[model samples]
Target: MKNMKISRRKMLIRSACLTIGSLFIPISYATAVNGNRHLSKGLDLIHKVLSRPLDVSISHLNKCLSSGKIDLENHEGFKDYINSLITVFNGHHHGEDEILFPTFEEKIKGADFSKLKKQHKEIHPIAEKIKDKINVTDPSFDNYEEIRNLLQKMNDLWIEHRDEEEGIVELDMEPLISSKEQIELNDKLSKHGRDMSEPANLILPFLIYNLEGSDRDTFTDDMPWILKNFVVPIIWKSKWEKMKPFLLA
Candidate 1:
């Protein structure tokens, strides 16, 4: 149950990062920020990387809910995916809260991050409710319906908060920070996220399973050399193989 709650929070943050990645700050705003290509490219890559998994997860949940039956095999598979999603999601936000937000706050004057902080606090209970449902060992279609409702509610709140945060960063914050600083911050946050999500076995594979073609290549390129060449291939292969079916299907 504790793990499930943590996973739920992680999923929420993962979705939020995807939202941030997809945001389109104005061309004028980009120009005004001294044209930080790193920040722009980094956000776009992050979106591309995370978007597929999010879409796959939501689609799978919807299918399970609408199918009117829940096979134990499928239920267990979904639980594993949820756990992986939780890890990545939590890692992303942990990076933001600990690395990005504090750093950004210092650079940008009179910026009030309390609201965003409050939103994170508020979101956890909603995520916990959905997680509780997902963690049920014998979930039925009825259980799926309950979970679906909870997820819908979570999505609404999360989307609003995520969009607002992105808007703040793009419109208000980026202008104040230098391009080099933004790039360094992005790197630190990315590293922090990967470190926090370690064991790399489940999280790396789950992320890869959802991505394809160019998006997969971009994600792989962004990975640390050892993780891309060795850790994923040599260390996590077995775990990934077991979980791949659920995520891909």
Candidate 2:
């Protein structure tokens, strides 16, 4: 009877310890243990996918403007390189503006992304301006100051918007949505983006090559087998070779 009483007391103590220990666990970590992957985990990859190319492009362009790499090298792969960066950036927001945002508004209760949508409205035009300039400008000729200044503006706007979106995903959306739902919605979002603004040669290499380490493995593992095997290696790699100086991979 005494041993039975001690066993009950130990169980109660263990229960109390678990309850108190849980108080120290982060809400997101606990949620992950509960089987809901944080929305930010997936979205962060997309954000990097969308932003890194532009960042590298901006960096290259700045170096060119400073040291006149623009006037040298016969333009080579530079123009196409910049285009690929901008295309991925544009394609992502296009998905968000056209599909993702609307879907979220419909599915998620109290999900008012009207401000985020407004940000897209503002962002796209600047992107378009840059696109227009890219269409005309090259390493040999064009106004570097205008391109530089516009990129600065876009960078400022994008950094703020990216943080805002990530915050919403982490704080508001993650609790409300599950890992499964985010994956499903991301599929819809990606399909829309592919339909809108992509050529595999530019988009795939730019995306896959820019990524590294675990992100590259995870993202590549998710890609269609044909792309992972044939299209990228046999067909597309040589095409982007001129841009090697700018590529991360």
Candidate 3:
């Protein structure tokens, strides 16, 4: 009887320890068995995917502006590059507004996305102004300073918006949503973005151009084998190369 009681007590203690230990597991790691750890992991992939292109675009513009003279021959190239950046930026936020945030709110009760939505609306005009400036401005050094100043303002606003949005998603929403659900939501968001944006021919190349080394590898690894093997090599490679001159080194 005494031995049986001791054994029972040990079993209870072991069970209690496991119950407590489970609570201490990081939210992200807690879903390891679900095979959605990639989704639960930090938002680094999303951040890099969205922000790297913006950073490259802004850096290229700044480098050109620093010289105080726009290269007339490459002026149209620069405009195209800026337009591509704007397209990706707008497409990403549109996906967040229409798909990602809505899904997040559904999972997290009492979630307030009004302020974030307002920020999106506020930045639209600034983005449109930059797009308009790129389209209408002459390819001369004459309006270089004006365009440079406008781009600088747009960059500042965009960075602020990006940081805030990331904080909301990573810090606030990540803990609330399960890893499996996040993976599913991420897929939905991506699909919605692809459906809403320009054709993959244009967007994919720009995304590829901005990513390098491990980021590039991870992105390509996630793509369908046919896209990575065929479409990227046959279609997007040249497009990326053509835009290379307007992008940062």
The alpha-carbon deviation from the true structure for residue 36 of candidate 1, after best TM-score superposition, in angstroms, is 1.7
Could you tell me the TM-score of candidate 1? 0.71
lDDT of 2 by residue, 1-249 (tens): 999999999778545533332222111111121256535765677677767766766776787778855644624566667677677676677767776677677888889898888887887788778776766534343565567778788888888899999998788867777678776766666556555444455566666667788876665654556555665655456666777776776
Clashes of each: 1, 0, 0
Best by TM-score: 2
Question: What TM-score fits each model?
Answer: 0.71, 0.77, 0.74
- Maximum-lDDT candidate: 2
Name the better of 2 and 3 by TM-score: 2
Q: Sorted by lDDT, highest first, which candidate order results?
A: 2, 3, 1
What's the lDDT of the predicted structure labeled candidate 3?
Answer: 0.61
Model 1 clash number = 1
Give model 2's TM-score versus the native structure.
Answer: 0.77
- In candidate 2 the C-alpha lDDT for residue 123 amounts to 79
How large an RMSD does model 1 have? 10.7
lDDT digits (tens) for residues 131-205 of candidate 3: 877785565554556556666776677678767766777677777777667767766655555654453444566
Error of 1 at 67 (Å): 2.9
Tens-digit lDDT track of model 1 for 43-153: 444444344554555666687666765656766667767666656556655566777679877877788888887777776676677667788777777777776676666
| Candidate 2 clash figure, as a count | 0
